[model samples]
Target: NESVWTADQNEEMSNTSASPDSVSLADVSAEKATQGSDTDLEVEDPEKAFAGVMGAELYLEACRLTEVVPVSHFIQNLSKPYVNLNHHGLGPKGVKAIAIALVSNGTITHLELEDNCILAEGAIYIAEMLRENSSLQELNISNNHLDTAGAEAIASLLLDNMSYLHALQLSGGLYALKQSHCVCTFVSLQGNYQVKELDLSHNGFSEKGGQLLGQMLARNTTLEILDLSWNHLSRKGTVALGTGLRGNGALKILNLSWNGIGNEGALALGEALKVNNVLVHLDISNNQINNEGAKNLCRGLEVNGKLKILKMANNPLTVEGATALLASVRKNHNCMMEEINISNVLVNETFIKLLDLVCRMRPELDVIHGEVEGCITKIPKQHPNPMKVIQKYLKEHNLQLWDFFRNIDKDGNMKIPVAAFRRAMMQQQNIPLDRVQIGELVRQLDRHRTGIVDY
Candidate 1:
């Protein structure tokens, strides 16, 4: 069958209120036969049909059917390839109408509906629409009140073979609702092969949520960039994620800033870096990593070759840690690292000299550090021994060291848990021992690695 409708004829048909029942099958056959030949129809413009069905008309019809107010701005922007209706207050009913209108749409490729108060129901409606539509490539629904069910529905869409989504942003609302575990649905991405970029920042993911994400990263192969910033992934969670990174081969850029992953987490990541060679950019700034963590990371940097950018700014690092990192870069002949950011750490002359040497060796490398404190012309001041510091504190307080140990050892046994020893040291404000010094004291007193120290 061949039907060639002119512009005028198409306009007339769009203006008409006639229902399909008004035209019989015989009438349609006769019109098709009189309009044009099959050869003529083969040359017709494919977009003609889409142009004639106005987006505004389709949206209005959907609004009427759903009993929701139609957004005039949304209708005006529907013809655009990227439609941003962020903060438009489109609740469940409003989004349902838009979803219906967009089901058959072929023009829009990107959609942003952030901060619209669209809850789980709205997310379900969007998931249903995506199941039938294949034109959208990017979707940002951040700040919507999507609970566990809603998140699962959206994640399930990724498993469909026909879905074309490449980038999805679902940050900012789950945390406020105390439903951070909703991110567990992302584990479905383990079987997905289309999504390349995912943003789950500000979700306040707990240790369990981190464990679930680790499971996903361990198996997903198509994901290239992931953003997990501004969450609460402490040491245990971070350690779990690092274990996943050891096996991942496709991730290129990862953001774990502001997650408070301390030295133990840094050690786990160092182990991962020793085996992973695909990651190119890493951001672990503001993670509370100190000298010990920096040294642990350097161990990995000395052997890895694929990483290019390392950002560790705003961390509590000193000259010794900074020097170690630079020296590691110099040792790795195959290292492709180009930039290392430690912006807030103050460096001394020794660190500066080492950085200069590393730069001379690899002219392309850029290291960002804070201003130099001072030049070290003589031997640097050694750290005060924890034992000596404790003795001095006891002498000033007129307290005997044996009495202090007896008080700590309440059970009359010579041994006391390391935690109790640390607590006793912390309570004496005059002890003047920082956490690092306290750790050193524990190490020196408990030489056997036992949980208890012999008082």
Candidate 2:
């Protein structure tokens, strides 16, 4: 015969067996029976038993349900604060599994999934996860095949008020999105206030894209660093962007390199600079800026004082343009210019003398230019060669040549790689040699055709 126990009966049994001294063998047996029944209930409905579990257990369950091959590194990184799964070839399904796992995860703060073939579907999954997850701060999804759909999903995620992401890298795939879709994404970004740094390089942004970006920049205030390098933001687009900059006050660093924004674009930026006071670093290198553009920039520099680093290298500016720019900096007593890079422009005695006077006024100012030209006939025959110029500059500035070499030699090896040497000579603030002189020096130093130069 079997009997059913009611709640009242169970309570009565538990109360009766509350005291160890008054407990009997029958009471102990009943308590054990109740425990076994509860265990059976848990086994019958395991999902209900573990419904609110989080972290690794939850991630593993997601992986199991999605049938994803759990990479060992990913599994290991589930407990870490930073996860790097770059170049893992994790396709849509794999990223979906990871997204499901990370939806409830609170540990990961930085996640890099670059070069993974996570297409549109995978991006959607990630976006959905981000809608729920708030711990993640930085996300790099560059080099993935995220097409228009994926970009739209990401843009929607940014529009969400719950998103806490600070840095977003969606570079290397913007060319796939149509102009309308790109405009949609940029419009979404305009409303976002959380993201501070954005990388949109390697994407061929046309005039439409530029206009969209300009409109976004006009309203968006939280963005600080923007990289628009290696794109096609030519005259019209650049002019629009410059118009946006005119009213913007939050942006500090902007990279517009390799965009063929010519004299017209430069004039637009010059107009923006006259009114804008917050921008600090501006890179307009490799643009088709000529003497007229340089003059336009000088006009801005004369009145504006906030700019610190200006990179105008590889433009078609002549010595006159360079001189005009330096002279503007000299004329502006309030200017805070620190480093000016015009490495592709030749300089003459007039420019050199003006640079010397400017340097004397602002000893910390570093000006970079190319080989001497234009007024070579006026220079005396006793003019020092490029090597002597470098030595003389270093000695006069109280900088050691070995220190420059050591800085480039990262491995502490006595020899510097040819590429590293050239880069250091051209970019290092202490080195006074220009590109043309550096090339000749490299050829003479590397006599054996070895790919390195001995100090």
Candidate 3:
């Protein structure tokens, strides 16, 4: 009798609230949907059920965590209320189909279909969606194997349906932006609104692409951040880009990392900065910015007042380059330059000691020296080579420092806990995820159990 009463009470409680189909997808995930086994129908409104199905939390988590989702189920049921849809491994046809469906429905906003098999025709479909779908805000189709046709499709979308897009990331070898034979200019400014950020990094763009983008910038208004990293923008390209920056007012962050911008290119950027005052962050890392280039940058810093954060890491900046930055910092009383990432440029004891002194003197600027010392655990010289060998293996595998610790207060999942130490470690290692660690491969989070005994 008591068990029956309890069952009745439980059923009453369950019926009074929402049902599974009516459950808020804002918190639920595809993993949960796949894992759950409940089939009982409960009393719930259709509106609530739809809200739950298309909630922001559920779709975002699904998009962010799982790189692969079944194309059919996702299009039919899942993509109702979500903004970002990052079905990474889904092929171009699948993505285009999904986008077409969403645009037809007129609900999706902020689509991010990065790291997929999307190419030319697929890009055109997305372009069509952009032109017609006025609700979508941001589009990131980066890391896809797209060519000139795809670029032209995107460019067409920019000219027609891409004004609302505040952020666009088309990085990772879509095509060469500067090839002589290519028809599409990097991105035309005909209808592009003053987009806040644009990342064309890692695309094969040389002098021609740089010059094309420069021409767009001369008249275009509103883009603040531009990332052209990993492109082969030689000295000629940099000089051409400088022409656009000479009198620019709204642009701020410019990333030319890994572009091989030698001293001459660096000099051009520096000269542009002398007059351009809006740019705050500049990343010239991984270039051949030798001591001469560093000196030129320092000269620009002296005259310029707006530039703040400078990242020259992984360049050929010897101790002399460090000295140049240190000298510039010493001169400015109100040192606007808050951060300088000089990790592996080979700074000797003298430079290190001088850096220590500079930090001790100012105590305001946080100069990050990413070189490993006894920070994690001391790798003793006298230890057995076998144990050392094991340790090296663990460190290389990223299971040495710590394990994935989840939050007790929030979601009870194995993720990188938000701790000061963990955040610092991630920054040093260049890991970008808020709750996951960057494993060996791109978009692959480290999931191996870190074999460390907790005290």
Candidates sorted on TM-score, descending = 2, 1, 3
Task: Assess candidate 2 and give its TM-score to the true structure.
Answer: 0.71
lDDT tens digits, residues 204-250, model 3?
77777777777766756778888888878888888878888886788
Regions of candidate 3 where Cα sits further than 4 Å from its true position: 1-73, 76-92, 104-107, 161-163, 177-191, 348-362, 370-455
Give lDDT: candidate 2, residue 362.
Answer: 62
Candidate 3: Cα lDDT at 48:
44
lDDT of 1 by residue, 71-129 (tens): 76788788889998887767665676688677778889999989876787778778888
lDDT for predicted candidate 2 compared with the true structure: 0.75
Looking at candidate 3, the ten consecutive residues that score lowest on lDDT are 435-444
lDDT of each: 0.75, 0.75, 0.59
The candidates, ranked best first by lDDT, are 1, 2, 3
TM per model? 0.69, 0.71, 0.62
Give residue 397's error in model 2 in angstroms: 20
Clashes of each: 0, 0, 3
Clashing pairs in 2: none
